[model samples]
Target: MDNFLETQLHPAEICVVCTEPFSLSHQPVALPCKHIFGHECIKKWLKSGQGNSSACPTCRYVVVEKRTPRVDFDTSSIWKALCDQPPERLNSLMMAIWPGLKILWQRHPSGNFSITEILDQAVIPALIKTARRTESPQDRSYDPVLDCYNLVAASWDSLGRPDTATGLAIAFVRLARLMSTASATLPKWLTSTARTNRLLWRANASLGIFELDVSWDFIIEATNLEEEQYFPLLHLYTVLVSQSIAHNSQPTPWPTRRHDIMNLVVERCCTKIGGTFWKGKPSNKFKDVLVAVYEELRRYQLEKGKMSLRGHDGEERVVKGIWALAGWTAKKVEVR
Candidate 1:
């Protein structure tokens, strides 16, 4: 009953990180694994790298797969051996190695390109090259890079420097679309994801949510166009709504309310940055720091309330309460 009430009060949509009950007032974040933690929890997780190779803890479902370099034999020796052998005798080796050559040609990084270029030119091509030859049917289309990209984008979007993060995300969306329509078939060794078509759509959808949070102008402009990537654009709308709630916790100081602060610090994040930040997610650190401050702030607020009754020590208490609310609210909405 307690758990039920907590979820009810908070709404199932809110973050589940801080052991706090869900709140109707908090922000809700959708993760790549299709699991929901608190916005704060997910944000911090994305920043810290915990989400990099993570799976859905509840189901042990893989969210993102790691990419490692493929091992290559000394082709110099193979070439020397092949020089004396007829082309017909070397058919097996040529068949075995040709795919690697194709992947290398496609992904080589040599020039400036969009996020699409980074993934197609370097990341996805690398994965394709590394995959085991016998892993799956040649028609299988599962690409883990999309999930990895989403996690990276999510981490960066929340932490700051949204421009860089946005670039990364846009690249994936573009590539996913391009691949969807291209005449070429997905190579074997990629898993079959026909059953997860919607999730693929959802993953793409999630990107737009963050984009929306970053700018309404982009959303408005996107809506007016005949665009095929609807998921990212709709996601932007969702992100804007979530951000509005999360950001509304503190009242602007009177002077600053009237005027913007010149010294304000702003950090944009991608999902990967948030998942495995310098150490852990910002949510985790933010919670620990806020909890300490909250203890003091709550005590000060109480002391001020008490002092106000006695006409002493009132101002400091009120100031502390004001300062503590942002952290408190963050704690309230964040899940672990």
Candidate 2:
């Protein structure tokens, strides 16, 4: 059976799971039914089944191997072969290599270093080259870049490396800029902009960067404020308030301009909530998020002395009004 299978299959045959030609990374493993598949594909297939029972994709024969066979081959030669593929096949080769790249990254001790190498060596260059080569808005090649970025971001977050995450976020902004120059329309630009902002907001908040102005600019460009619903507004308020507290606590004296930005963010939050309240139709979620933001602000003010003395009276008045609008007394909103 092994001889027959070997005679029937060629090294150049494609893997059924990845749909790419078999190479060192995707060596074929034969089943009892004489069906051949990539080793990784069959391993995943068996693992996804119940109690080690699985069927072959081609012949539906019950797979009985206790373990998938492993084959050792020269990765360098395989990579060289892939690199030698024609230009049109580059995307497919990239897709084929992605799983192995991810596996290599996961096995590394330092996720930060692994992700950095992946981005610097493979993902970024491929994305930039692909973007430059393809001018059509309808091209699907760019999807891989977004996917790879998300994967890296998620991995970095899981590894608690917000510094690296922030770096990747900045790289995404650069990628977005490149995409913008490629005649990207509003929707495409906005998609990239929103993704960049989301990553930046989370990373910056974690790192206490607190650059609210830049974050707000990205938010405004990505979303239409008037047409936005609750969650977007909620995200904006949360980022603004959290970063305000962070900025206030920095060693450098808090800038008066930052106080104004905080005030502006608060005012916008109140205006939105007030509109809903006046209509006798306030969203509980919106109010809850606003209340959380207010609570955080109040906590910062009490813990870090006064956040602002320049607008002491005016800030007090605005806080009082916002509390009143929310139907909350001073006691109800005190920091615990």
> lDDT by residue for model 2 over 36-65, one digit each (tens)?
788988777766645434678777787654
- TM-score of structure candidate 1: 0.20
TM-score for all models, in order of appearance:
0.20, 0.22
lDDT of 1 by residue, 148-221 (tens): 43344455546662334343344343334322311022223221223122223333343343341223233333
lDDT of 2 at 269: 46
Question: What's the CA RMSD for each of the models?
Answer: 30.9, 19.8
Clashing pairs in 2: none
In order, candidate lDDTs are 0.35, 0.41
